[model samples]
Target: MSAAIPPADESLYAPLQAAAWRLGHLGQSLDGFIGTAGGRADAINGPENLDHLHRLRALADAVVVGAGTVVADDPRLTVRRVAGDNPVRVVVDPRGALLPDHRVFQDGAAPTLQASLEPGPAPGRAERLVVARRDGALALDDLFAQLAARGLRRIFVEGGGQTVSRCLAAGLLDRLQLCLAPLLLGGGRRGLAVPEAASMAEALRAPCRTYAMGADVLFDFDLSV
Candidate 1:
């Protein structure tokens, strides 16, 4: 319904120009937890961060998420907090584990697509794109290829931890915008779990910039390096 993203917020996502740019984000606690052990994730960031999220969604061609996020949040994945057109919703549900009646599938605000291993009936109005399985898992390369073929570039990979972790581990993420809240979740879901560094020399390092968004601190990393 809206025409374009606001200029102020647009400045936050100017790096996403290419068709294959994959930017990921997660709202984590001080202890690096994205959600509780039982998959409960509520508002961790304040107004500014939420607006930032909507702006990111507005600029993206598609918003990608895993089946776990779909099942846990049932988010509409639309640009509602700001004025902009909603992006296409992409669900990486290789096993078709997400519920058919989820709100993401029911919402008619944006075009929805599900990438799965087995071709079957799509939930609601979503179109199913069968991604061939590799080693009994969905091949990230093939999935992105298919999405690119469909003209979906500038993807926003928003998360549950597993999805973000997989993308981070696979080196598929171009940029990472992490909003860290002050709260602490001592025994909750991790923000990211990748291969451990053997030593300080083998650690992953990248240029990062920080910003204060209300009560949260946003860290923007150039993961492409």
Candidate 2:
């Protein structure tokens, strides 16, 4: 494990600080206003986030994302974070809708594990986790328990908005680190889109510290459960 995040408890059965759930907005303002690229507006959190994720990835055994994110971004979930062992890329596809050739499972970046409702006789040339679910939502609690048992105890829940919201509302997240971009969408997709925050202030809960990334203010919410 990386010597970065310390354990929050002793037993470590409950979940140690070794794991972190990174929830950030992929916005222009948030990027330009806070996290900058080479002293300029960082339209995204830039390498700062990549670096943070890297630290988390080094300690974590698996990195996860919702299928929507895969379809939308088609990200190649690899650990360019600072180099250690390459973490396993896990995708959540309840109905196996990731479209066989999205490039997320190609190129041999790392082993891509697909957890779906059906086995389908193939793990898409990667790894397969034929999990059962009721409403297509993978039994989150059970999945996490199994992941922990599989040595993926320190897990990172990287995501799409809905996925992040669901995981947090379920109280399954241990910590949430968000890098707030400066630009305001006013109406674009929100970086953090979940249930209605009781109020704006309540929504952007206090005790939440803010840091200046580049042009955006990094709002890190410590959702340590």
Candidate 3:
């Protein structure tokens, strides 16, 4: 069944309207694992939560993911489960290891942008965006600036753990939506890896709200505020 996200206050998204707003989304188990040790994420989220992801993709100007996620999931990254147009797909692949056969490159449902550290030709219908490196890694700030130059303002960072962690660490994430399933994966990849705080006061806190997407619980945090 399909589910609707609770209506957000207009002010909450006002900052996004002016420029590129990056939002991160993750679906994890009760124990806070996005994938199993074997790197499988097919059954992490239920139908409703899956629908919610599609809704997010539909709403955003671009859907971004890491190269590892594409290699692991081979997702189409389209708005197939929801009612809306597909957003552009942005892949952060510093090594240029992603193959042209990946579904996102072949589907052609949306424009694909590939960010690589070295200058090279992108396969399939994807456009190669050469990003500057800071200490031998793609500079996240430059990547966002390039996307903004293309007029892709609202971006959805849906990814593997490492990519999400990078965004959170860099303070590039303006909003976060974590949907928790009722299952527990004892050991696996974490959803987000922010720095640990010494005390509760030092912990990262943001204005948060919750909603029910069928059996799953969605926690919405407004980091932009």
lDDT of model 3 at residue 217? 91
Please give the TM-score that candidate 3 achieves against the real structure. Answer: 0.90
| Model 2 TM-score, 2 decimals | 0.74
What would the per-residue lDDT of candidate 2 be over residues 31-141, giving only the tens digit for each residue?
223212222222355565556556556656778877877776677766665656667777888777677776667768777788777777444566668775746477766
Higher lDDT: candidate 2 or 3? 3
Task: Name the weakest run of 10 consecutive residues (lDDT summed) in model 1.
Answer: 2-11
Each model's total of backbone clashes: 0, 15, 0
| lDDT (CA) per prediction | 0.84, 0.59, 0.83
Clashing pairs in 1: none
lDDT of 1 by residue, 59-129 (tens): 78889999988877788899988788899999999987677898878878899999899999999989898
> Which should have the higher TM-score, number 1 or number 3?
1
Please provide the root mean square deviation of candidate 2 (C-alpha atoms, Å). 6.1
Clashes of 1: 0
